[model samples]
Target: MRCEEIRELLVAHADGELDDVERERVDSHLANCPACRRERAAFESTGNLLSLLGPVPGAGRSISARVMATVRGEDPWCGHIRRELTAFVDGELTEAEARPVREHLATCAACAAESRALERTGDALRAWKLPSMRIGLARLFAPPRARGRLLRFAAALAAACLLLAVGIAFFVSESGTATPPPGLLRAMEMLDPATLEILDQDPGLLEIVRDLELLESVTDEEVALLTLNGSGG
Candidate 1:
């Protein structure tokens, strides 16, 4: 398995959900893949720390209320309200839903206040502080437990950053310099003028900047069809 495959499986492995075959594959792959191992370790450690921190206060209250209402069978609109309110709380609402919610919040004092309260609660919740032990300001004088966790966090962060930088470098080089599929430029000529508006914004030109690769491929396909039909080849 590749690094991405191993990295994804690592979570399951850490949770002890991997079957024997999957476990063996992850072990075999991790032996040859230091980067994936590090990514796995980083995520595991992050998950550990978050679990230790416990759930966010009152994050469940809205859901709990909805569940209770459903049990009572008295609030017919409960389901709709819960789904929309949860999506709005998570900023997952589409533009259409967002407009209605915004309008509702504007005219409805209760919802407007609830929105502010929720925002304030979110800000306050982010203030969850992990206790840090501060030893005397001296090299090699810190408490062992504090020093160990600190070192682990620092190492994980450094490794993660290095991996990200390397990955970005590889992607950039591949996208910018890799040989294009033949007739790519011809396709560019055929894409709709409106579609080209976004491509035109690419300082590297539509074909040159390759970071948004999936989008680039889509544009290329559109352009290629145009180029081929136009050329009658």
Candidate 2:
């Protein structure tokens, strides 16, 4: 290929878009011609500079709008600001991250109204009085180790209660054929044969129940430790 042909294909060569035969011809010409080689280098340098300029402005917002339009059947421009409104309201974003969002909200009435709505929702949540639960429901979602420990503690308590019921039944039976107390008979009836078998198989459970207070104290301390670690993280 001549220098003119090679120069015309330099951009394609720099981008690796030329066919193998065309690329080979260009390479052969470029190696022999200083001017063509310089042209190829310049094309590559220009490409690098263009890449540093980043994506076109509003390109991300345009794509986000299209996606929101498809998924939500709403206007596209609102999608970008709507997604960030919660973070803006919560003061979760740094100033650099929040500036464009703030500017958009200022100019876009719909987005500004949505931001106000989010603020109101947050205020309502903070003001609401939730009912207190004796049991911490948060424990249900604790890390696996914590959850396992809680399950074991619960099992020990349950086994202890079952063992107490069994002891009461024995006491009633041993009372020289006297009629059992009212609830004692009912409790004995509720103690199924399967449960009695489980207790019989796992005698270690009785030991756990005996140290239930210590186990409970240890669990509380560990839970407190875990809460501190999570907050620190």
Top candidate by lDDT: 2
Residue 217, candidate 1: alpha-carbon lDDT: 22
Extract clashing residue pairs from model 1.
187-223, 187-224
Compose the digit string of candidate 1's lDDT tens values, residues 1-233: 77777877898987788999999999888888888888778878977887787867768768988886457444343334444764687587889877777776676554566566455443332332211211111222345554233223222222322333344334434564322333432342234544434433322332221221222222454434323322331
Candidate 2 yields a Cα-based lDDT of 0.59
Candidate 2 local lDDT, 1-233, one digit each (tens): 77877788999999999999999999888888999888899999999998898977765767887786466525565687688778899999999979999998888776787787567544533432212111332543355664333434333344544444444445444662223345643453355545555444444554454332222323555445433433332
TM-score of candidate 2 versus the correct structure, residues matched by position: 0.30
Candidate 2 segments exceeding 4 Å error: 1-75, 135-233
Error of 1 at 213 (Å): 75
Of candidate 1, the 10-residue stretch with the lowest lDDT total is: 129-138
Lowest-sum lDDT 10-residue window in model 2: 128-137
Q: In candidate 1, residue 220 scores what lDDT? A: 54
